[model samples]
Target chain A: MTVQTPGLIATPKPRHAPALRLRRLQEISLGYLLLAPALIILIVFEILPIFYGVGISMCDWKTGAALGVEGWQRWIAPCVSFIGIDSYTRAFTDPAMWHSLLVTATYSLISVPVQLGLGLLLAYLLFQKVRGQQAFRVLFFMPYITSTVASAAIWAFLYNPDKGLINSILTRFGVPEIRWLSDTTGIFQVLLKPAGVDLPSGLEGPSIAMLALIIYTTWVFVGYDITIFLAGLGNIPAELYDAAKVDGASGWTLFRHITFPLLSPTTFFLLMLTVIGTFKAFNHIWVMTQGGPGDATTTASIYIFKQLFQLNRYGYSAALSFILFFIILILTVFQNRFAGRRVVYD
Target chain B: MNRDKLKSQLTNLGIHAILISGALFMVFPFAWMILGSLQTFHETTLGTFLPEQPMWSNYYDAIVAMNGAKPCVFDPAAPLDILTREKGCMIVRYFFNTMVMGLGTVLGVLTTGTLAGYAFARMNFPGRETLFKLLLATMMIPGELTLIPNYVFMVWFPTPESWIATALNLPNAEPHNWIDTYYALIIPWIATVFSIFLFRQFFRGIPNELFDAALLDGATHSRFLISVVLPLSKPVLITSALLTFLGSWNALMWPMLVTNSPEMRPIQVGLRSLITEAGTQTQLLLAGATVTIIPIIILYLFLQRWFVEGISNVGIRG
Candidate 1:
């Protein structure tokens, strides 16, 4: 009653589908094998350590003890011992920590804008085909490559009160030689001393030591900013400038219309990096000041380091580190939110 | 019209002068450091821009002092006990330690990071996205957070209470702590997330078709990676290696933390102690600084092109 298809011969559904799926699973397993080393290292060294750090923050750990679950005694032990949020309370309430925060903020606030502005200006000047630009670039970029410790040491010598070149120069100009590093007195305070302007102690500017650090840091990083700006400048088409010239847009107009907008992304990047770097700064502070002269240059990182290493206050240091991490995090997020929106990608 | 041209020419000359001055300002520290190294101790402390008398002996003294042999011993009975010791420098030893540690780190980072980067770039597996994100998130945490835990690990690893000696079945491990050992420096920095991330980004930019072609040609994943991916990623590898080397070479904090003995100390830490000891010897300190800077300068000169290109690409991609 029905015609049978001879060649097709009532083919049973292919039974190799499951086998194919199994082979696909095997391929994925191979993929995992390929990625396992990196993932394992990241998990151990980076990700797990952060959570471990959080756990350590809750503990009263010492140098000898293993940083295991047993070390969480400070956070968990009951009526006889438990200290809930005490370390955090100590860190947040500590006046030194607050002072450190203020110092860090002030340093970042002043240095970021100046570095970015100068970097952009330099990039622009270079882009204009100034003579010996390559030599100039190398000169500016030289500081970034210098070791931070060496540079700090050099700067420390320069800031020395006696036999410093700066002091000698000041003396030559008929100005009084001011104590640079050892002076905890702020610049504004010194300036206002001659005038009868009474300012509150807290309203004084950063200590001269901190000022020197800021200057050194700015000098070290300005070239990096300039390099970034130069790269950004390269991305802009020459036609944009050509068109602006055709429209009689010269000097300020050309920069305002064509260059600035195009360089926004680089500016945004430099700003974020500078903020993060300034917040996390430690090497120079450690080498130059050791947070000395009554904590004038004790940035958050140095404060935390002192607590952890110098004083062996593990829990408290961990808490301070977390606070710093959050401050940087919040600033980074804010920067991304605003700067990301404004950056001209094209 | 001719007068206008003259005025413009004057303005251009003024601009060039300003640029040259700025360049000089930037370069002055290096210039001074070099000049200071050539001066006598007295001349250096006097802060002369140019050395009054160039003393090549300063370099010899610096080298000898850093060798850390024949240390000056003082008796309180002698009036000149307060004078500086003419110790032979141990800088040679410190330099060796730094090189070994630096190379060890470079090897570890390159090997592990390459593997990880390849997986992240070319492979699609379970938990891949989540793991990558976790890796990125770790970068947000300040490094200080992990410092204590890592220290604890280094001090306590291979044992619960005893040092690594008892656990390793090695004789006389009880008294000696790993704190001042080179292992302390090398083990902690082996897993570099930044390098892994950098290599991953670079690898991702490589085309997928190459991998497929290699696969069609029946090459195994490992072979394909070694022959194709590694060669293709040479620029990034060199860049990362140089950065890793420089970072390890210039490391002050971790080495300062772990190593106390001068015998095991790296150059940065050694330099710190040297400066403190020779605080009065400005010329010697300058010579030490010069010695430290020379290797870096040479490396930079040799790899300048790769450095610029690598940094730009990494920065943009990151």
Candidate 2:
């Protein structure tokens, strides 16, 4: 699930009294009337659109010119022919699309672990009693709350190859300037080139540009993950630590045996979320790199966006969205089946 | 005891070091942005930490540039009409536009969410359970998947006039221009499931006797909602309003897609064009970024207590 409405509500006494009362004409009418406005808006705007989306995905729909100026009329009376799996098959053969999948997969693969691991570590670091900790929390959480475009804009300037702070710092250490966001060279390939090591074509890791993007992503979300983890840490009864300490449990031992086990559920949740977040990350990527430096950072979301908005390929974008959807669904299911069981609930 | 004190001191020092450094790292981009905004265009990429001379004029120019083609100034010293004008003062206009969208979204969400949430929690309705479960299920659907279809619908959905005319056997009627309207920005965003879920959850906390008492007093459901539930749900209401306002305020993709004209565009759109369109104008771009984020930051700072509780509760409850 993208969002979990997990908090339970208190069960009222005399359950379904209102429900039973609804057998009367006025009561039933009131019930429907109460729900009608919200329901109508939701259905008309959100729910019906999903079915409409799937319908569009199946049809060989083009721009408004082809489908008529008032496109909803086309939906009323049919004109477009059903493409029938053509979009999906075309996606399979399309190299740019496949490479985009690779980039998105790699981004998720690299960024999720880094974010989760560092986020967990930071959570532990801040979980300790510290002076002015609240200030730190506010500062760290700012990025998560701030507009991604603004954050990405700031980072874009920071990642400037010629004058960015990172390169500036690197120069002070007597290192040559390194192209940050502009560098399409795979990090591994760049690292290995001095030693005359060459990897095969497909195994060349993610580009430096992607790494820059990932770093920005990590910075943006690390605080969020830390905040979540801090809450998780707070949930662990302090008595466990106290009792364990009384029994001669050291910091490492307590964390290893008690804290780690108890915190696994939150850790797993953040991990899954970070991965899902990476797949959907767009505003930052769009603002920062536009998935650029020669398609080195083009994630599936960005690719789908370009198709729909830039190329006017609505049907194709819809198809790509479904493909991405199935991938996420399958991955989520896979994680739930295999990895979710490892989470130790408190 | 001395050893333990020393160890604790060392640990606190270590914690402070790490926390402070991390905070600095997180905050540096914002600092840099503010600094960069004040620097001249050439000086921005000079790898300087501070501006040679701070220029507030970047902000003035950014406003003048984005405030539309009409020449305008926001100077308080300027005449009242200059401040009030909509033509060339697009930054102000977009700012107002975004605020309207934000307020409209919050109101729509609150009204609809409370109604739906109340009905679901307190009232009995046919298919209510199924509809709610369906709502929850729809939550899983990726919002990006709905983008194209929603866009198409907004652009070309049958106008109410056309539909009514057809039903009434009238000759002709024009379609509603759903896109680039206040409705476009505010309508689709109103049915926020999470907010509805939140209201419903909070509503469930109200004791059954409250409703029973209200019923005894001849209060209708709306009356109960207004007099009792709404008054009691200040925390949830504030949190919901803040979150919805923030979401709508920071909205980039949907509004960018729907609104094409300058006056209709929001701050986020203006901020994006400030970067993508006028790429080399780093000072103005950074200034635009700073200006764009300042409102939310101010709001967040003001509501820090509730916002923190909201954030923590969201994660903890999840």
Candidate 3:
């Protein structure tokens, strides 16, 4: 750590090795001192809770109430019994857990694509020298910034079966009043019933209530995708587009050849994020549906919340959360292995 | 050339048409919220697009309901009395709580993030890289998993009142814990990995000559950070502050889980209760929703450039 620029400082270098060692010691202590606050908080809050969750998942803890036990003892021996891996096994075998997982998969599979497509289209349109582009971007991004609870409340009003705006618009077109939030019928079944098409239970898509949630989720998140896409679009060298145009390529041809390939990294990034986001999504769904209309919109997060908060099944809920973590991790790893290769990083 | 000009003008018009329509769809709910907040209950249930006569009273009723006060029986005698007495409304308290929480979170994050970020950026400590890598690894662990255990831990901590009452043998205070307190709300969230990462990157980009000069002047690390580095890092500070404030303000689920009393609830949870309790009072519900989000909307409008730029910049890099 000798000061190399001696002319600038005009101070004699501490060529004494002992002073340098003391300085090194001082630097180490200061570095640790600076890191102490953040490290302590992170370790206590973020890191320990994870191990604590694993421990809790292995217990038979219920409401965590004890007659005489108080303080930390409530979480330890004599109050909560140790039960190894029962909750994990239960989560695996429980039909409700599988159903919730199915609902989550259905919600993510449908909403992510819709969001990505709409976001890409909108970002592409905005990438052009359009007027009021900033206004458009701000308005679209409004939902992302606003509190989900407030927006979900508004959306719930707009989805009111008796007097909702959407149904009003539909009914104006001679369509019947649709139960936007309360309907539990699978949406594909509802849509295809008129076509005399019958599908089995497992093949049924997300319920109408779930479809409403998917739409709401798309509305909240599409703006974020658009912003990210716009950034990605900006990163593309303008020379590529100009070269393509010089070679007599039309706008569509240029986008197809140059833009899409270059945007794959962003697309893949969004895809992974969207999948993870959909998995993590709970606020709007909880606010809007509460996994309601017969568990139609019960994504795994909702189910976990219900179990832990409403039903007081703490141990079981912890196990379910671990299952969810593993699912997200596996999905991410799988995507990296299969989809990450296709990304054009350069 | 004349035909091409006409065609390009048409294309421009078409793009405007599509974008404006999309933008309208994006903003339609906010428009509806504002309009609906001023509507009569009958108008809301009737799906009226606009109110025949604006009902400004709905906002007052929303505030009263949010406060968990007894619904005022409208009397012809004192038409304006209820509005005057409504100064102690819980929504006002919720706003205060939110402000305190937001400021506390911002202060905590800036302090911790800057200190740790400076260490990571400039200091030569053993295990520095390993510790930072560990911090980043925690970001991948989904928050939902930690939530349950965090709740348990929060519940396990003794409430200050009960602990004091027991120690002094003063009175039998109601048994509760840190679940509903500000500590539970603010502490766990302050040390975010993203903020630390953001500060670290920004600090690393600063020229080394400044640090060298500061060291020559015998300035301590804290002194250098406060005097030199912090002044140079205004943009990052604002970005982090705005983001942290926004996050704490809009938080719903964690706050909902932690706080049960209307006295402790932030606006989001309070607005949530309004939805359930004001079952048929759709107008009041919309009014409450509007009241809940209007502050955020105003803040967003004012600082939107930073919001948009900061988000996109972080999105691109992270």
The most accurate candidate by TM-score is 3
Q: What's the CA error at residue B83 for candidate 1, in Å?
A: 27
Give the TM-score (vs. native) of candidate 2.
Answer: 0.87
For model 3, the superposed segments whose C-alpha errors exceed 4 Å read A1-26, A62-80, B69-87, B122-124, B140-144, B158-177, B204-224
DockQ of 1: 0.34
Sorted by TM-score (best first), the order is 3, 2, 1
DockQ rank, highest first? 3, 2, 1
List the DockQ of the predictions in order: 0.34, 0.45, 0.54
- For residues B1-318, write the lDDT of model 2, one tens digit per residue: 999999988988887888888888899998999998899888876888788889999888777666554467556555444435452376777788899999999998888888888888888657888988878656556566787667777876555666687778776655556777888898888867777787777788799878877776767777898899989988878888888998888899899888877768888988888777567888888888889989899888888666666555556554
Instruction: Give the per-residue lDDT of model 2 (tens digit) for A162-219.
Output: 7777788889998778888888888888888888999876667888899998889888
**Model 1 chain B: which ten-residue window has the lowest total lDDT?**
B79-88
Deviation in angstroms for B140 in model 2?
4.0
Which pairs in model 3 have colliding backbones?
none
CAPRI tier for the interface of model 1: acceptable
Provide the overall lDDT of each model, using Cα atoms, as 2-decimal numbers.
0.75, 0.79, 0.83
Alpha-carbon deviation at A138 in model 2, angstroms:
0.7
lDDT per residue (tens digit) for residues B201-292 in model 3: 87987998998888878887889998999999987888889989999999887898788666677777778788889988889988988887
**Which numbered prediction scores highest in DockQ against the true structure?**
3
